[model samples]
Target: MYKARAWLSRSFTALSSNPLRVCVVGSGPAGFYTAEKTLKAHQEAQVDIIDRLPTPFGLVRSGVAPDHPETKIVINQFSRVVQHERCSFFGNVTLGSSVSLSELRQLYHVVVLAYGAESDRALGIPGEDLIGVHSAREFVWWYNGHPDGKNLSPDLKSTDTAVILGQGNVALDVARILLRPTEELATTDIASYAWTALEGSSIRKVYLVGRRGPVQAACTAKELREILGIKNLYVHIREDDLIKSPTDEEEMKNSRIQRRVYELLSKAAASASSQPMLGQRELHFVFFRKPDSFLESNERSGHVSGVHFEKTALKGGGPGKQYAVGTGEFEDLDCGMVLKSIGYKSVPVNGLPFDNHKGIVPNIRGRVLKNISGDSSQVENGLYVCGWLKRGPTGIIATNLYCAEETVASISEDLEQGVLASSSGLPKPGREGLLQLLDNRNVRPVPFSAWEKIDSEEKRLGSLRNKPKEKLTTYEDLLKVAT
Candidate 1:
């Protein structure tokens, strides 16, 4: 049996008298930042940040490109935040799956749904369901040792020509990973098993596909620059995609990264016409075509062979206004592997108001809106959101510092107005939910103690490998050694 009464202490005063108990659901930048800011703002406040994975730092651990170790330095700062005495880090506790949202509300004065987007947005093409097709989210996780990543061997062996469906920084990362040398990958936190498989990959070409023209590409200038700088990867671009002339003064203010990317891309386009790709592995950046279907190798094989596309033209205004004008020309890009990096996907937490379309808890200025009253300006208190789950998937690691600040400020305001403390914490569901999960024989979640064993073991394995660490990829392997 589980004890809620003993855990729930009425010793803590309401916001009107003192601090509030804040529970943030997710340990990503947004969640950690929120926790850090709240603790800094209030002396008596206690914070708990929960994560589904035994380890914390959601995207920092699983989403960031492993080769970019500098970017991952963020984990150190987040680790400091979690070590605060007022802060409690709960690992291996999954919301929605392991614990109901109602129980969480009863345990904390305010609950923030910061469990960032978990699913990948689709390209809606025919070959999506094929064997070689995968989402960038899954692929990145595999290389980064995310607990739920699929085995890397299957995807690595099946493709020579890979097509990625997006122009964001994530797409560039996949392209670089596909072509980067084995020596380059050894220095990062990429899983050893995944790197070993990638070292032997047959993939010779990676195409970063975008549905709009080069000027409209969502990829940041810095990502495009680093990608082109890869020594082993041959960066290719078509002349048609090269932006010809600057339109306005604002357009002329391109960042240094953008200016450098232009110089490199111009050279690539010029060479694309004269040379037959220099090396076997070519990273071609393509734009202005929308996916039509995923070409599968007969119904029996269930393997993705290629992708069909409908060439698109710009319409109306810039960026957001630029829609797929007229769909006339059609083209097919041959690809053995397909990665839909179109975007990110998230779902509403149980017992919270969710906008089905946006896949986020509905909030106004970080304040979770319970109901739209007769007067629309006012919002009910006691709930909030932070991170990707709050503001969709975008922004660099540092940007979350500001995002979390805003939510924490709103929470402070709510506390000053005596909104959250009135509700107190969520109820005690006891072991009923966990018992059901155990009955189903879902992989036994690693307890905090078990995670410590895994952590120590991983470090021990890393010492032998001459690298940071190696992770156990399988649930069976993890349980066998961890237990």
Candidate 2:
């Protein structure tokens, strides 16, 4: 294998050339996937993947549910992608700050913005501005040890009941984390600090809330079912909680895993209502609670204490059917902590046009918008976007493969047309347009070779501990350790 990789590297270097420089911002699944596609599709092309986290594997390192170690195995595959002869990595990078899209366009013939979303959707409710309110995004980062989330520590020490808003996979993730035993978390890459805090949780009940009915919920069937399978926890479901819906063939036929999930949920639910004697923990699958306001204890606490929800009724199609958020009734649930898993959001990088509301680069298809012509401007030529950054944040891992391919096809088309940033090749005698743009913006993107050393050191350390490589969470740590 070593000999084979060495041979491939030599061949790749021999084939690589100018005019095929590609830079990808963000080292998440999407970013690395895009770089891998570009390098493999065009062996002569040079690919550089960058990220603000001194580490790579964006969400895998910072946001994937820590209990899902198998899911994180995807990182090993990405490691090989980053090892491409034509590829490199630059951690501790801020696109708008350290490297601007404008400057990247100057150096690389094609600059693909594959950075995934950077923020979370705001649950605009009354007490949301208070001391107890938080987003699952922040919670995930804190537990995962993202540098930006290093200081985030929620007081789960005394919590008896917790509320998580939104029913997506992320909402389910937080619920599981709050309920899992410490022994289960031992093998995962969960930060030591997070483990200690979580180990001490007094949490007895967690309500995973959703605005829409169960059938209409955004969470995938797999994610929802897995959470219900926890052995000791009671899963409560009110008959009224699950809006009636006609069953699909898949749901009726009961695939093997789906059958197991149903059995477990039934068992948990029966145990919850029958015994009501849950000694240490409880989990509920709740629906039809549209959060109208967040209850707070302090002004600057920025933490949520509880949630005020508006009563919503199905339009007779069942809970999963389209339902309306109305003023027919209202209810307040009591809890000391609340997490808004409403959804993930994108952040506007510096220079490239952005839609503050959508958290996506303003684009048509995969193209960046030069300007908003009217309803929406056409995507700009040469500048392409893919994955979460291209589309507003959503979709699982496989979803990005097709997404990245779409962008790659666009890049290939642009290259054939000679419509890229003109004269972005080697530095010329007098005037360098792209370099001048980088100078004007003060953006400095990293190269691919640098990423190799960072990858090596991280894995070397990871092997020692039996966890995925322990990430260099701080920017300085990455710069100091990475070649």
Candidate 3:
């Protein structure tokens, strides 16, 4: 008991004498939230956030729909978090290239991997690699001016009809962008190149295809409502498809949000025939259809002309618990473009234990586990994860707050337990060591102050154009602005 007490005293003394050094390997919502929680709980801890891009706010800046500018208000909060005295931002510094995970483990006492999903799930179907097929992830990033997406020029000129395979908010977002008037998006921070391409878009019809029924839709009620409210866009729905089964009815009764969504969908379907307008684009909800393959166009070789689908039906479970089973029946929809919006997936970082099935780093609570089962005894000390990388790619932006808090709590508990004690005789050098290494590598990291300059420049350009901030889509331009 005396030795135990003495060890505890020494641990606290060590932590108190020198502040804990924490390195967060992402500048997204999860990273910022973790930093905020860590800074608030451990006043002596210094946190450093690093990102692959010069600008921060991962998805908020690159993944969100351009027209939904209000959703990005969280950036203001993230900015303040980065500006904290105990926190530092290091942008344009990639984890694998600029420094290895092993190097980070050596430099900081604790390393938090908050880097969100970097890849999209693929639709394992024939002709998916065709010219006209694109992942909704790439499309969203292209419109939002992500440096990696700047070169992706989707062929909007060839298609009057587009089929998006998924019913999530992301699918709705893609549909809304395709159907929304260009004038509405002009005022937003959409990439100028995207705006130019969209102005010439021939798309007039969009089919939001999903494998599951309406009750199992992944989109939120707010997004559904917004999609329904778009002017000059006629929402087409099959009345039979909206009819709920006895099981679905019971599920809807239990969920207020589901009940409301059903009611709204019913109302829209009922009014579809009565309210008719000319020269209007059509948004069709095609449910219970699983993409079987993409059909090639005879006129344009290697380009997708349409999609083949196997009809699906709900089995056993109810509402969100339901799963889609393919029926013998088959159907085809002729469309020039296909955007697969199934979901996002996290890519495996070098030297990390990633579960390919779950698309996440194998972890118990917040501590990264050694294997896929996440055995408690195999916990990787001083290593943690939060957000989509910890959990799968699920939930909204606000969801990261709770997830990050939980991770921070786990980290705090570990600290108190002395699980983060240095194994080597030498103490970790933390940010100072990292900066010196970065300097040695000739890697010019964009600091928060430099980012502020870029922000100011964007706003200045926006003011001149009478629109939201104009983004630097290319790395060269962004680097120049930052400098």
TM-score, per-candidate, Cα-based: 0.86, 0.83, 0.95
In order of TM-score, best first, we have 3, 1, 2
How does model 3 fare in lDDT? 0.88
Q: Rank the candidates by lDDT, best first.
A: 3, 1, 2
How high is the CA lDDT of each candidate model?
0.72, 0.70, 0.88
lDDT of 3 by residue, 336-408 (tens): 9999998899988888999999899998768999888867999989999999999999999999988887788
Candidate 1 on 1-483: residue-level lDDT in tens? 012222121133444343467788888888988888777766667778777877777888788887787887887788788778777776667887766777677656677778889987765545577788888888888888876884645467666799988988888888788888878888666788888888889888889888876656667767877877776556678777775433311332544444455565677677554443556568888878888888877643888888888888766553235555547888888878888888888866656766656666667657777643323355545678887777778878887887777787777666655566543433322233343543475635554456568767877887887767676666666666657
RMSD of 3: 3.9
- Candidate 3, residue 89: CA error in Å? 0.3
- What lDDT does model 1 reach? 0.72
The per-candidate count of clashes, in order, stands at: 9, 14, 0
Against the correct fold, how does model 2 do in TM-score? 0.83
lDDT of 2 by residue, 263-318 (tens): 44445555565444638588877777788888764543555667788877655342
- Poorest 10 consecutive residues by lDDT, candidate 3: 4-13
Worst 10 residues of 2 by lDDT: 7-16
